[model samples]
Target chain A: MKCPLCGLEFNQEDGLKGCSGCKSMGACGLIKCPNCGYEVPAESGIVKFIKRWRKKTDESK
Target chain B: MTVNLSRKRPQCHSTADMEIDARRSVVLVGSPNVGKSVVFGNLTGMYVTVSNYPGTTVEITRGRLADDSRAVAITDTPGMYSLLSITEEERVARRVLMENRPDMVVHVADTKNIERMLHLTVQLLEAGMPLVLDLNLMDEAERLGMRVDTKVLKERLGIPVVATVATKGMGMDELKKMILKEDILPSGPPLRYPETIENAIADIAKNLDSSYGISKRAVALLLLQDDHEIWQMVRDREPERYALVDAIVKHARERFADPLNYIITIERQRFINTLIEDAMDNDQVKGIPFRERLSRLSMHPVAGVPIFLGIIYLLYEFVGVFGAQTAVDFLEETVFGQYINPVANRIVSSIIPWKVLQDLFVNEYGIITLGIRYAIAIILPIVTTFFIAFSIIEDTGYLPRLAMLIDRVFKKIGLNGRAVIPVVLGFGCDTMATMVTRTLETRRERVIATLLLALAIPCSAQMGVILALLSGSTKALGIFVMVMGTVFLFVGFLAARLMPGERPLFYMEVPPLRWPKLSNVLTKTYTRVEWYFKEVLPLFILASILIWAGRITGLFDLVIKVLSYPTGWIGLPPEASKAFLYGFFRRDFGAAGLYDLKTSGALSGVPLVVSIITIALFMPCIAQFSMTIKERGWKMAVGMAAFIFPFAFVVGYLVNLILNGLGVVL
Candidate 1:
């Protein structure tokens, strides 16, 4: 996902990997951009479901 | 050929193997999201091993090229913009390049952003790497009516160039051919700095007795730019020669008005402009797209104020009128008041025989009647709507533009535009935002930002409750906003004047505004609301218990009596002192206390607005105070709190005096 602040695109896992040292311990539910420390909310299950469904439909098309 | 793909870190590569394969390896390097991964996939085929780099959590991917004949190993380094790194990813990427001394270094760049990408290219060349400039995303560049003369680019940079739409497999064969070519040599540095800098670089390089894998010239440049890693490396490697190099850097720095890094970047950018002019053409007219025009308008000084006000108005309508009033009334009145509270009271009364226990769970200030009701019925809908609105605004990419627009205003507060990130996030959660103040460039900026956040910025929960409390009177709401805004600016101005520090420079990228994706907005809102519930629900229950305990012990009344003196001085009723007490626990809890009083007809009109302003400007909650202590240390945190609490009441006292003195009736 693209970082909202600096526009750097990084994988969510990569972003989270760098956040291990954050004081919140990920309970804040924010995924910080690895490039800049800008925090963004992680995608929810509903969003993931919708995304997967959309991808499947696109592949079928 | 089966590629060895291991996800585990320890098993990925032995140190000896890494050293042995260094010469035959290829490392793909580029800024984030420039298609380096895609290019790596094309070269290495389906299977690749990913492991954490040694001593760091940053993942590094490695695989053997698909061509079994050469059996050349390829590693895809993390995205990095420059050798003088800031983020750990960039540092790891540079370490990979310098340590591996790869036979081929492919600098994958987005063709559409070649100008920005070339900054890294110039650095790589300066580092004397054997680089092949792969202009990825060719289709996107062409769609933008951009064309790059690859032959001219290759000729000018003295490196091989390949153009490819990596996702579509275009130019793959050529890229493969280039990677496979033997005898690729490091290109000479493409940029020559001013004479003073060049002479310094030469001087530093001549004194270097150690081989640092890369050219001594690159080390000199990194040292001149004050790259900490290079400084440490040079200090460790050339302990005797380090001082001589350091003196040379200091002498060169003395000759420049600006920082050496800035000076060097300007020179490199100038060289890149000429190179781009010679090798690139754009058939598309210079007409701004609608998005671009909108972005510009949003950052325009005069135009942006209305846009900012417009956003605030929309937020007021959505969160205040709709969520705070409509939804809150339904939940607080119909759901909790009519149904949940009655049932809870009955259940607790029937089960717990003692009146004290019963009151603890059901009566006035009861856990169920006040704590759960406030958390779910009052604060929930308001924060939900706020998070929704905030998510939409964030997804639209307007915050950075807002940052740019406010940069000038922020400078007066001794903060640059970057402080906007923490300041805006403070509205959501000041505790979390306090943690983010570390992003500010200077200690002074962080302290000021932290103070402003603690003082004037109301978190969403508190703002929502206050909005609901004042929703009845527009004049009251307007007064509340005006007072808070004035205090924010006045205090920040004073702090800036009092604090001694270098003036901060503001620079930020303003991404084009786009329609917010519903999925993204919903996801963000859901995550935030869920977090709020997890964090806040228990706090509410605990606050209720603590209040119950304090009342039983008579400690609560003593505190309330003492608090009521200042509460009365602010022209608030004695009952409002309870809210002020709660304000120390959580600002939103204090606001909710005011909400209860307002509903009961115990507080209204000017006193309501006065109490709200004072509470809004009160010291941050216990959590935020602890964070302040953590971030700023004990002395600073205590100092800020010591000044803030009295300052808040004093401001309240003054606003009350001026308003009543003017006989302005709400």
Candidate 2:
């Protein structure tokens, strides 16, 4: 899947991911452009989930 | 691609005990207003308004950036986008990066929209600034069904990329580790351009012999686009090198179909795309996930309406009924009313001989007898339960789901999904929600939200008491709903009509539902209750002091006398006048007074209903008045009070008339 906006291609899991804020496609990119808080969509869930779970696991340890 | 950007040389100079060494200080440097303040506050211990919309954070807020680092100072800068500064704010951030250069910089970007944001990230990498990319608002990204393979992207960029939900404090640890490690080194096959572009870049890099902070190759690319900041920096320090860079940019600009910036952005996208393709594999089903399907059903006009009502009912049942009726009665009457106040009165009478002094401590309106008791006994328990419930809702991230569920309906009345927070919060505290109106995207939305909050949404105390009161009466509850619902919709529509503006679009990143964490919920509850106690306890005690003074001065009698006509008109007893006055001090106090009247059998059905209705529509507490003044200014606060005073009585009169006229004898 290609992020139509950014054109970052990934697989199915990457296409259907959510952010930590609200779990929708509204605010998942990184931060609102430090310049503008405009909402930007990211890739899907696989990479995002792995990264987050890894982060959480790291914290727990 | 984790890069070690930290190099230490600065002498220990900061005198503040809070000073964090560069090794410990993982500065979250990004463009302002990118939730950096929130990340800082959450990681460290601070309280910054999540949304004040004041973009220029002139002074940096320092927090002991918590996590794996024993104690680090996290710095939040005004919103800035790139290393190449165009705006003064950007220059400030760049200066921070150059001067205090912390162990690492966490680049927080709105995850939903990364294409535009990543440009700055790329620039930072090019500048070789120590960095970890935080794909913040992962909740928002997931809601929109966009996926980001940060690990893959991390591998490709060769920098530590951590995704975060800074608002809810998710992924902070991973972000911290990534920052502490400063592990990703920004190295890759520098993004290759088309052969023609490659030759052009080669020509430029060959001529430009400048050992800048970043690679000269990256400098050449920035120069090609005529990045003014970079160009200015080069011109000042290396005019000879800049002259060559200028020629390459002019030539490249001539070759590009679009503007040079656009052309560069396209190339950057190409690079990001290529990297994603190699490292990422998203395995999502087509059409919709079961969650999305459930969400669709939940938002359906038919199904959603019922669900919304059901949720509202549950909220009232737990918060209003259980909290207001059971917990409040037990605490206010059985505990405080029966035992504490009497014991305190006897003790104060025995200890203090001066009547005036005794009045201050244990009289009818004494601080101990009334103020502290009310704050601790009546408000605390209710607020604790409420904050716990609220934190859970917020943590589970159901609010956005509820927003989407009701967005369509809200749109019809000139509101959007964002209005959900204010309206829902109004149930907990209208004053707080009024302050939150700043979050609405538009001035019109703020006005409408504020109006709805004041006119309809009862603050927690009033709402809970009212809910408790009416929960027993099917007809009364139905009537209450009809009246409040009608007024909310009607006023919102009217405000939207009067306010001149384009209807701002509704967009919310509705995160997937999750079970709320208990500790997080408890912490949030504790914070809220502590704040509530601070605000309420003082005001309640001050109110008691005022009441005592009023009694001694005969001011209380005069006010009660003045209130008598309205009381008579509304068909209530003379003592009810005191309740109305207390209502102004705090709605819950008036509610407690009403309970005092009800339990004593002073007023029954019609008068009770009328009195309840009127007080519910009446002015909020002294604290609320002060808050209203602080937030909306004197004009709105005074005007709101002016309308509410007689308006409550007049409405009470009308309701009495209607019920009396209809022979509504319950």
Candidate 3:
């Protein structure tokens, strides 16, 4: 995801790696941009599900 | 050939006597998302192995080049902006470059952002690394009507330059051929500083006796910039000459008004500008793009205020009126009030023999009736809409522009524009925003930003509840906004005056405004709402159980009775003390309590507005307080709370006195 603040694009995994020391302990579900430390919420399971479903449908088509 | 890709501890200064392999090693390096990993894959194919750089969590990828005849190992280092590292990842990348002494260093850059990317390119050249400049993302550069004359660039920088859209396999063969060539050599430093710095660099380089993997000129430059790691290394390795080098750096620093880092960067940028002038063509359409014009207007001093107010009004309509009023009313009155509460009360009353046990699940303060209802019915709708609106705003890339718009005002408050990032984010979550204050350059700025956040900035859930509480009367809402805004600026100004600190410098990149992608907004909203529910629901239920326990133990009444004096002094009813008590648990809980009071005709008119202002300025939630303690330490956190709680009531008292004294009708 691209950091809206600094325009640095990074992998979600990389963003999570930066969050290892945060007090929220991943319960906050925020992904901190590795470059700028700007936090944005990670995608929820429902959204991921919808995305996967859409991708499967597209493939079928 | 078998390769061990297991994590290896970085040998900072010792590369001698390490096992040497016949395979020529190449390291791919760049800023984030410039296709370094993709280029790595292109060079190495499917035989890649990943491992953490030892002592750090940052990953390193290594593989052999796909060509069977030539034995070549390719390593992809973490993305880094500069050799003068700020982040751990950047430090690791620099370590990889300095320690490995790779036969080839490929600096993959985003072609569209060559201006920004060239800073790193210049640093690589200064290091005298065997460098190849790969201008990746050429398709994007072309789309932006940018053309880089690779031949001219190569000739100017005295290095190989390859342009490729790595994802499309464009220029892969050329890149491969360039990497395979054995003749690549150090391109030498690409810039010369002013005479003072040049003299200092020459002095420092002359004293260095031991070999640093990179050029001694680069070491001298890093030393002049007071690079701590190099300072330690030089002190360790060249102990006798370290003092002279340190004196040279100090003398050089005394000659410049700015820090050597800033001075050096300016000189490098000046060189890059002239270099770019000769080698690149920007054929972007002659006129300013509409988006660019809109972006400018959004940050314009005169025009930005209305745009800011316009955004606030839209938020009020969406989250306040629609979510807090309409959606909340349906969920609270129709779903919980009409259906869930009655059924739960009846079922609990029938099943549970003891009235105490029954009260735990039903009645006014029951876990099921109050906690669940408040969480699912009132707070949920409000925060959901808030998250949706916020996600849209963020996706539009308006926050950075907002930061720029507010920078001038923020400077007066001992904060640079960067503080705006945390302040705006505080609306979403103050706890997170407090954590983010680490990004500020000075400790003083962080403290001021933290105090302001704790005192005046209400999180999204709390703001939504207050907006709903005030939405009935525009005059009342107007006064509420006016009073809170006054307190925010007033306190911030006072904090700035009281705190002794250097004036903060402001700089931020304002990304171009774009129509928000619907999918992104939706996904962001869903994620935030999900997080909100996951975090808040259990806490609300726990609060309810604790409230029940406290009431039974008579602790709740004692606290509420003590709280009532302040509540009454603020012109609020005695019952409102319960909300004040709840406020410390979570700011939104208190606001939700007030929503209940208003609905029951217990709180109204001037008192309602005063209570909202007070609660908004009240001590931050328990989580935020703990975060404050963690970020600012115990003494500072305690001092802030000591000032905030009473100050909140005093301000509330004064607002109440003025409004009633003026005979202002709500």
- Per-candidate TM vs. native? 0.81, 0.57, 0.79
Give the best candidate by lDDT. 3
What is the alpha-carbon lDDT of model 1 when measured against the actual structure? 0.83
Query: By descending TM-score, how would the candidates be arranged?
Result: 1, 3, 2
Interface RMSD (Cα, Å) for model 3? 2.6
User: Which residue ranges in model 3 land beyond 4 Å of their true spot?
Assistant: A10-29, A42-61, B1-28, B35-78, B84-106, B130-212, B217-286, B412-414, B439-441, B472-481, B657-666
Docking class of 2: incorrect
Question: Which residue window of length 10 is worst by lDDT in model 1 chain A?
Answer: A13-22
Q: Candidate 2 on B413-460: residue-level lDDT in tens?
A: 765556666676666667556655665655566667766676667876
Cand. 2 Cα-lDDT = 0.64
lDDT of 1 by residue, B65-105 (tens): 64545667888998897888867788899998888888888
In model 1, state the lDDT of residue B199. 100
Model 3 pairs whose backbones collide: none
TM-score of chain B of each: 0.82, 0.60, 0.79
The lDDT for every candidate, in the order shown, is 0.83, 0.64, 0.83
